[model samples]
Target: MASAPLNEVCLAALTLSIVFLTILWYKLTSNISHKEESRLPPGPRGLPIVGFLTFLRPNLHHQLTELSQHYGPIYKLWLGSKLCVVLNSPSLAKEVVRDQDSVFANRDPPIAGLVATYGGIDIGFSPYGSYWRDMRKLFVREMLSNRNLEASYSLRRHEVRKTIRNVHTKIGNLINIFELACVTKMNVVMSTMFDSNFVEKHRIDGAEFRELVVKFLQVMGKPNISDFFPMLARFDLQGIQKEMEAVLKSVDSILDPAINERMKMLSEGEIWGKGKKDFLQILLELMEQKDIEISVDLVKIKAILVDIMIGGTDTTITTIEWVMTELLNNPEIMGKVQRELKDVVGMNNIVEESHIPNLHYLDAVLKETLRLHPALPLLLPKRPSQSAVVGGYTIPKGTKVFLNVYAIHRDPQVWESPLEFQPERFLNSTNLDYAGNNMKYLPFGSGRRVCAGLPLAEKILMLILASLLHSYDWKLPEGENVDLSEEFGLVIKKSKSLFAIPTPRLPNFELYQ
Candidate 1:
């Protein structure tokens, strides 16, 4: 009788515990259901698993803008297993890039970008962290500081003058503007990185380099099924990852020898010409220093170099081509730019960087060009570290985000004539600039991940654009017209190559030499 009573007591205790656990689980699930009832942003409900994958087009920026129209400024879409959010309005952009910048600063790099950036260690593709901060700080202070740029001025000037001479030789003949700009910009980038002597020795600005840059960018912008479905990434079905790997290897081959040579020279205690450190030397020195807070390595250095090389050459060249195209399309605008060039930089004299400051009209023209055609229309993809509320909607953790600056720049509500090529809008606006402070006009993006090379890019772009207009009088080939059609990529480019005839306008032919 005693044992029987003890067994009943044990069974009763077990039954009570099971009842308690069930109540707890029911309460937790009910709370979760209430929380998720209406939290997700409004969006289209596509077909079962693949989602909106079939509706995408090659012009991703344009397509995203269209989607924003239907779903409002902030909307979510399911692409395969991925959840993507598109931000269209300026206020929403500010919210993410400013108020929640640190939360959204991380990059969800595509497979191709991961390979191109050495597993996303470069500043462009790296995650937001101490390492990224240190790398960017080093790049800004040591590589692209005003002092460093001044030291490398001779290299930039030499290449630009050489371009002027080359164009003079091709006077009255059809000149491919893209090719001309790409070669000159590549030379400037290489010379700045490794000094002009090293660049000349390696012939780093050859056609091969040009082809590689174009292909690399094309691959970067290409959409892959692997990106949409992570499970399929390892299979390499699209070959994008493999292609990027080959490109990175080729880039490595070019940069490796130059790096080794610089390291060797540094070991022997040799100084660069006039004791001025080129980009490579400075980076190598940082790598050797043990006292610094951040550690540097060959992979990081090469990744940075690749970022500079591709970013410097491709974007600058594309912008130059677009500026030329716009000017050609609107001859009156072209005349105005030429007249300003003549007034600021005399017809008898060649253009110089010093004259750039006085060319206000030219500055307006450049702002206008980027306003219409930001090199990076989508401004690279960003991701959230954790679930957060943005624009009154909950964005779940790790959703791919695209800030459509292209659409923001062309918003009819903000601009007077959004489609027109009017440079006057930016004339006196102090707030609107490449600084990325103004949400409405972020051609180079904004926030912690804003472009680090804007200063260098501004100087080079102004110098090159001014020089081309000042030294040469350009016209479309006879019976030909300007094509405003665009072909989008990592950098937006004109579908048709600009072929223009040039005539030297300088009074002194000796300047060509």
Candidate 2:
């Protein structure tokens, strides 16, 4: 009787344990399924805690491209605690960035922007508001207006000549044209912004400024742990804020001296009396005008300089480098462009700004290059100012949105054989510019915050590209193939440095002198 009672007690304990486990498993699975069905876009399920982070590779574009194949155009992925919705088609991108532009016009204040701009006070990161409107208007009217363009024309022409001379001197030697392009572009912007030039004998802090700008761009482009986790944002989890602050300090050190010098000149009536016209001079004039306070912190001044440095240098150079690389890799296309340049500008003359308009084939090549490798493969992240529905999904207010320009550009549905580098496609099409009206090409972005420097950048790039093509026939160094692989940061850069050998064309030989 005692043995039977003991066996019954053991049996009861085993049965209860099994029943409890079954209930717990059911509840956990049920909760997960419910969460999954709550209307999030299709995506690969990720592992616990770390999410899909481990799956991400160094070449983020490739990783995203592959994921889009399996997950459709609009897909979701978790980076740590944050949910990222990537728009993969041109139409979808237009929906988010164009059709609903106002709803998504606000910028997501990245850690770098916050620190660099002193908490989103700068034009680039300032949320969509009255202040941003005011600053943007100032940028447009004073800095990039036609008057400013005319003022800077002489400096641009001089820089173009300097670049040609540099290339002419390097005729038989292997040269990294990308580096040359960067230096030349920087000099042009510097000359216009400050009355200084990057002469061989007069090194006016160009190296220091270049170093600081590069550092700032790299740090700002890094993936921040704080960005993905809202809880850790305030803590600056990955030390991004610290890194940014250090860069900002370096930038301010260089900028403040220039600003102070200009201020002193203004107080002394040196600028007004001389009747000089420079970017700084123009801005000072605006600052003094009635109805404009010009904020004591000099936010407008710093912001304009930052915009020039950020907007002016890397992007234009990168575009030129990519175009040159593509042309070199595909000689047929290059030959066509060269022929066009020769026909339009003629071999006897240098390609001046006046010549750019007539170089249709060269313009097409530039558009094609931008289509393939937009500087910001994913343009700056935009945040929703208010809750809205996009493609049937509710986007909560403050949700970060990104238009994947890379994916959109590469989509086969939009362009036949999208991977091919055929500039002819652009020649055949009526729509070829970066204005928001055209969804197919948005290298300069679109809508309210479209790049302020678009006109200047386009003019400079076209002139430089046409001039180089008109002046020289270029070849890749050695037997190496020109690599089209890309790396992304604040801007996308070639994975390998593009080195080439340039031989001056006989027709444009006189221009080199």
Candidate 3:
């Protein structure tokens, strides 16, 4: 009986080995034939089962740049089952974003994003189709048009002044610059999102909103194993999905009541003649319209609101932090900016929207800051709607494509002294505007999915930087140096919080108040 059992065990072991070998052989042949037929981009052949997933590190942008050097500009990597293609050169970036834009407009959003964006129905992650186009049109033409943004200037001005006042009280103490900017951005975005009367009557907690944004960004930036291996997505081993759901719930708790109140007010004609209706009021008005093809439901309204709040706050703050960081590190640049501000708006006067056009150097400083440290370094990942050829390599349908704007901005072939932080590079260059026509310096990306918030983002960023710099002189804490090191996530921020002391710079003390 023992001999018979041993023979059966041996036979089972042999059968398993044969099956494994047969499967391996079939996969090898199929991949070989596919490669010959597909002409796939060159890339590293990672380990058999896991691929390059385990080799990925923090600061993914830097890692991808390094890979570009070894594998040429356009390359592919098997990140588990997903095939990701990274485009490092401007030409290739243009090919995906401009040449074949429609084919590559859809987003392969992470699981966390889908949850946060109400199943990816928002402008950020919605698939490329009529729905996406309609939402984008609503956002660009109606919500963030110059008319609306101009009307909302007072809201921005008020929040920025409040931040200046708060900073004035904390003079001579170490202040966290990122935190300061974060609060100011959050308040400005909230004020602009809803009318003052609504915010005041609804008693929406700004602090709670800030906390929610922080948590949401944190979870969104985390690398979930589920994203790499879709088979594990249902498991959500990292709890990212759960965290995102909780954030959405919190977001809805605040937004739902406010939206309902706004709707109720609109029903009774309470919002008419309310000093230029705010974004929330405008969206509510659109929601009730029966003539439009795309019905603006409550979820769509809330999702767009979330997009403005989260997208507006984080990118604005991150860019401001980088601008301040770059200025602090390069004192001469900082001095030049201050001198320009003083000349443009006189030391006695405050920064106004009209003054922005004349502050050319300050504008260049912002451009250079974005060049060196774009908020979304790699930009949001895109997916092709169908099989397409990019850089002469076949990008199969549904491959994750990353236009490495970080690398393109720093390419020596394109930029002179690519690594330097010289704002002068952009001083008189009208060709390098943020409109995405110039593919080499796409800090805000290009093509159909370029940042729709560009108009509002630019206004707030310029206002914040001008206000802070013109009002206060910033210095690093005693015995400390400005660290330009970065921490990469959904957005790239300084690896460490920038702590600085501020002294009122203007001759007029009352300006701060």
Best by TM-score: 3
Best by lDDT: 3
| Residue-by-residue lDDT tens digits, candidate 3, 1-513 | 889999999999989966664554345334334663469899988865457888988989999999999999999987766788999998898898888999999999999989999999999999999999999999898888888777778878888898999999998998998999999998888888885556777788888889989998888888888887675689888888998998889999989998888788788976442466578888888888888767899999999998998876788898998999999999999999999999999899988887888889999999999999988888999998888998788988878899899999889999999999999989878889887889888988889999989998888889889989998899997789889898888888889988889999998888888
Backbone clashes, candidate 1 = 0
The better candidate by lDDT, 2 or 3, is: 3
How does model 2 score by TM-score?
0.88
| Model 1 per-residue lDDT tens digits across residues 101-152 | 9999998889998999899889988989999999999899878888888887
> After best superposition, candidate 1 residue 42: deviation in angstroms?
1.7
- TM-score of every candidate: 0.90, 0.88, 0.92
Off by over 4 Å in 2: 1-37, 197-203, 271-276, 292-297, 506-510
lDDT of 2 by residue, 1-513 (tens): 899989999999978955664553344334323443476577778755445877888877768878889888777776655556777777777787778988888888677778877777777888887888888887777677887777777778777788898889888898887888888888777766766532332345877777777888788788887776555577786888998998988888877777777788778876431333567667766777777634424766777778777765788988899999999989999999889877877777777888777888888889989989988887887877776666666555665677778887888888889999988888877766867567877887888888877888888998788878888899877778879888866778998889999898955456797
Model 3: worst 10 consecutive residues (lDDT sum): 24-33
Shift of residue 5 alpha carbon in model 1, Å: 70
Error of 3 at 420 (Å): 1.0
lDDT of 1: 0.85
As for model 1, its CA RMSD to the true structure in angstroms is 10.8
